[model samples]
Target: MKYMSICIISFFNLIFFSISLFIMSLYFIMNEYVIFLEWEVVSLNSLSIVMTFLFDWMSLMFMSFVLLISSLVIYYSKEYMSGDLNINRFIMLVLMFVLSMMLLIISPNLISILLGWDGLGLISYCLVIYFNNVKSYNAGMLTALMNRIGDVALLLAIAWMLNYGSWNYYYYLDYMKNDNNMMLIGGLVMLAAMTKSAQIPFSSWLPAAMAAPTPVSALVHSSTLVTAGIYLLIRFNLLLVNTWMSQLLLLISGLTMFMSGLGANFEFDLKKIIALSTLSQLGLMMMILSMGYYKLAFFHLLTHALFKALLFMCAGMIIHNMNNFQDLRLMGGLSIYMPLTSSCFNIANLALCGMPFLAGFYSKDLILEIASLSVLNMFIYYLFYFSTGLTVCYSFRLVYYSMTGELNCSSLNVLNNEGWIMLKGMLGLMFMSIIGGSMLSWLIFLTPPMICLPSLMKFMTLLVCVIGGLIGYFISKISLFFINKSLNNYMTSLFVGSMWFMPYISTYGLINYSLKIGMNTFKNFDQGWIEFIGSQNLYNKLVNFSKFNNVVMNNNLKIYLLIFILWIMILMMFLMFL
Candidate 1:
């Protein structure tokens, strides 16, 4: 059985590798060709729409990230879910989702993009409910509902484009370059992006999505599905540049970043904490997208995929070994029992916390630099800087609380090795998370290489991360001081004590008012004059009304019959005269 699983996993990896190579080769070829050829539409049909595939540097970079993370996830899932009853079904869904996402990445038209967009949503919902538990089912449904809202926006935008303007991609592209209505389309697209990316109000579904299997959470939420919205915005950057929609995106993105970070602090479930972190990081990516630096956003997405997946997988390993306990309070000093897992977790956390020389530092620092240099409002730049502090706080808290505290589990079942297959997958990602940024710099068409950060700024960012981590460590220690007296009192007052009672109060008030109105109306209707007429002996009243109605209808029928006969006579005389 183990050998069979290994063979199956290896086959999938081979297939993905071949496809990735094909995509990269095509990207290079088309990128050169697009510069010389006139933009042309190839086909337009109900089933599919294919355009002259243009490969800019940004698209190439995104495609590469998608391919890399997707391949790693598939490899990891085989071991992680090996003994599951529906492993084959799970793998099939993962493959289908990956194919659809790849199609979305390269899709040229709005319709093709939506096809891929909804495909990701569908597969993700399936994966979230893979466990067949009620919680998983409910979470999947919530995610589907939220994503459907975004899907509707995209659908409406497509309809508007087709009916009001042109249905073809090239036509729309031409129109966007010169049309005044670009703002309307841009706004609609931004709404669609916000929902898919899980920004602000739409973000509530993502945290609940932690009910999914950790691999699903790691792959879909951390890497691909959540990034699709940012991909859409970047794909249509030219249309969104220098618009009010861009400013709105920046504002919402900043708010989401801060709010999700704060929410992570309150969460005790390990997966949910990571889920919130994904949301926060995605918000930051959206903010970077708003700055019109698609490359930087893509860079952040790629680096995040490596580290975040590692974190989730490590969390999964820890939970799986512990019989699926997810609370951080139950996990303490895992570093001694699971050294490799703990080490991998810390490395990924270091990357996530933006430690110097790690992959996250390179990408995150680029975003901060871009934000600082942005021609937009200065407040946004400062907001981005402030959010970094929160990012560090939550990220380090996850690491410290899980790995640094005293070992609390009794009679630990210490496995000599966590499964080699799973370890291999983690090691692959850990390698990438360490050096993926420099490699990405070489792959893309950017100046001075991405690794070449200004020394002073790099030092300051590193200092911020260290300071944030230390502060977070101390705060977690003193958290118990507030946990018992003040924390409980505060939560009780804020939620359970005051505003929590409002629903019952409101319901009672509504019922009471409704009864009062009903009683008054009933009293008015029961007034003696109308009641006296209605209360006349029922049998006699019915008989009299029936007789009156019958007499009136009979008289009317006779009169109509006479008039018809007279009209017929007149017509006959007139015909004879003629």
Candidate 2:
């Protein structure tokens, strides 16, 4: 316990250091001169790959928030993980994750960025499987493999960068504007980002990763792992701004947001609901980014990190008190028993739903307003708003089931108010969640975006929230059987409840298709054609030659005499020619 307390204090020191550095970096931000620290690793005749670190307002500001949240999480985990024997290991893993994120934040060189990127994937896998349970193992494998796809894509992008003679992308983004190689690099980079960020096709891993401890979830889902992709895209936005791939990213990101939002409404597990919410928010970040609003996307990333981390920590408290049960059906009236944790949870949820003046409003509401103003296709228009409404829909439903309904846990279960460390963590973030958006908005946006839209478009967010609230209320209040009996509702429920079958498609569908293709190739090409022409055909020819030799030898003296006479005649002819 003493060691844990000391560890928490050390993290506070990191927070202080980051804050001071951010203030110092502000001057450089104004001058727009990026600070670069470099050391030569190797210099071959014409090609040199050097270690490089980039410092700018964006990296510093984002790093500051990441440090603050990570410090709070470390403090919170002291109480949350106190019962575990390997608490020190957990804390160290969390620290390693923070370090990896910092490295990623400061790297301008694709080569250096890979170190950080791979560190994130490797450390996250360790943290995810920390529990040593079957569920944790499976989740970790899924998480690692999914992230590995991104890692490979990033490596390919780095290979493409060799054409530019430098791995430092900051120097080449503008120069390589219309180059085809750059286009391929941009596409690969987006694919990498999509995987790390859990966008669409790679979305299943984020939710499955909830098998890790809650504190890890709070950190990974909220800030570190998922945000890594958004950070990369923020850096690469200049190159991707006008590409068709950006448009495709816009489509996929919109679908991801809508799909996750719908899935959250049907999810019963409390942690999973929160995980899906993270996915939804990630989609929001990616969608805004695809539109080239990198700064705004980054703004949301920071604010979302605050509230989502707080939300997960609050859920940790609930799960702790409930004997580790995560089902919303087994939880209710927790507010009566643990008022502080409940309040924090509600605040985080409200913030997530974009309650005015909360952390999410500054970013999420602005994102919606911007989307509405953009001259997008009708499908994207509807998706943007519908996803926004679904956020409220699931949030309200979760609140009703977990916080306000009749007591659902076992009579023996006693909700304790003993999470001093946990509450301390939540208090800091709760305060931030309430004010982070407004504070960041002032700091980052010199002048808020000016949108002159019709009154209907302006108030669309409010109207959707209200309608979503009412629908969410009715759905939660009504009996499950009544809702399930209807055939249409049943179908819709199955579709939405299963995340539109994304998990099955990504996990089973991809594996099945890949295996099928591999098997067909092996059978038709490697086994059939290659075997017939190379190995099998060569073996048959060798066997026929051996049989002919054996038959000639078996013809005894006659064959030998004929061969000798022919050889003698050939020898005499060669001598005469010589």
Count clashes in each candidate, considering only residues at least 3 apart in sequence or on different chains.
0, 0
lDDT of 1 by residue, 475-501 (tens): 677775775367745754564322233
What lDDT would candidate 2 get against the real structure? 0.88
- The TM-score values for the models, in the order shown, are 0.79, 0.87
The model with the greatest TM-score is: 2
- The alpha-carbon RMSD values of the candidates against the true structure, listed in the order shown, are 10.7, 7.6
lDDT tens digits, residue span 112-147, model 2: 889999999999999989989999998899999999
True lDDT of residue 505, candidate 2:
83
